[model samples]
Target: MIVVVEGISAAGKTTWCHQNAAQFLIKESYPEKRPDRQAGPGEAARIWTDWNAKRWSDAVAMERAQGVAVCDTDPLKLHFIWAMWQIGEVAESHWTAQLKFTRQALQDQRLGFADHYLFKKIDPDVAQAQKDHDAARSRPNFDLHLRLHASLVVWYETIEKVLSGRLNWELSETLPAAEHTPNPYRYDVSVFDRFIQMLPRPRR
Candidate 1:
């Protein structure tokens, strides 16, 4: 089983994962520092494409060994791509390339769609308060983060719609199934593809 905890910055994603002590897979940190400046068009796409591919590989490997995995973020990097586009840090071609790669990863099962997604839904005021508390990390554009959070909420809803009966939807952190219940529906590439395509374009 693989579960993904998702939200905007300071939305308590990392904190929940830590508190649960699940096999937390985090992609934000790299052994080396990332390129500070935005890369030219396709370059940025290529970098993230490869980065997510590796993330998928690592997560799968862990699951194979441990039987369960919990991720701080999804390997699709949906929010990251949208946020970058909103900030004008990436071009359409870059987003296109990344989306293509994401589609391929889903199709190939290199990255399995998360069995469950836990979204930390909070009011805008609460989100702002959390952001302010985490002052050590620079969030120069709070509004952009808020918009990204809204976008992700919509995307997750679309995913649930596409998966419909197949997905076990749970808004809170509570487990969706009992210990004895069988999980009949597995990852469906077609449903996942539709979910990916349904993601809204970043507002300019």
Candidate 2:
């Protein structure tokens, strides 16, 4: 089962996936693992090329190996992210680079994940609770924060459409609630239990 935990930054997806899934495959999870480079690094392409290659490769290997792989984010989400950046007075070039990196990753099958759970209704109080739990965790990207919340209803609907049309997969924006605290990792066990209940069995 490929279970992807997707949401805005600092939405407790990483925490939730760790608790619920057998394996986790977020981008930062294996920062030391690098793949063979497909594109050359130069002045303009240095940062973008490296980021995409590593992310794409890691995704491919992890998905192939794990039974219950939990991806913290999906590159498809990049479209919204980059758009947010552009609308929030970010450098046009940077936003373009984000889209380019995501496009390359998707084309190479690195960003292709199945069984996504798109978290919705990221309450500010819930976000604050998570922030209090980790000092190193910075605030969500400002542009993304403003853009996603302002248009989440539309964004969520659009994502569902894309999932069906391009990936032939279903998408939902809800998950089992955390029993205590905002840690998503705590919810992984419940997710696995629910999966088991859905399986078929041999005749008695």
Query: What's every prediction's RMSD, in angstroms?
Result: 3.7, 13.6
Local error of candidate 1 at residue 124 (angstroms): 2.0
For model 2, which pairs clash?
15-184, 15-185, 16-184, 16-185, 19-185, 19-188, 20-188
In model 1, residue pairs whose N, Cα or C atoms come closer than 3 Å (at least 3 residues apart or on different chains), thus clashing, are none
- Name the lDDT of candidate 1: 0.64
CA deviation > 4 Å runs, candidate 2: 27-46, 75-77, 80-83, 113-115, 133-148, 151-156, 165-204
Candidate with the greatest lDDT versus the true structure:
1
lDDT of each residue in 1-204, candidate 1, tens digit only: 666677777777776777673544544444265543245645655566667767767766766786656677777675577556655666667667666766676666665666666777777888788888887878676677776766666766776776554343333554434232222333466666666677766666
Candidate 2 lDDT by residue in tens digits, 1-204: 344455555566666655655354554332354332233212233344455455645655665775334456543444443444435534445545554664555455544434544444576666667666778866656335645553443444454553442221222433333221222222243332343233322122
**Model 1: lDDT of residue 113:** 68
- List clash counts for every candidate, in order: 0, 7
TM-score per candidate = 0.76, 0.56
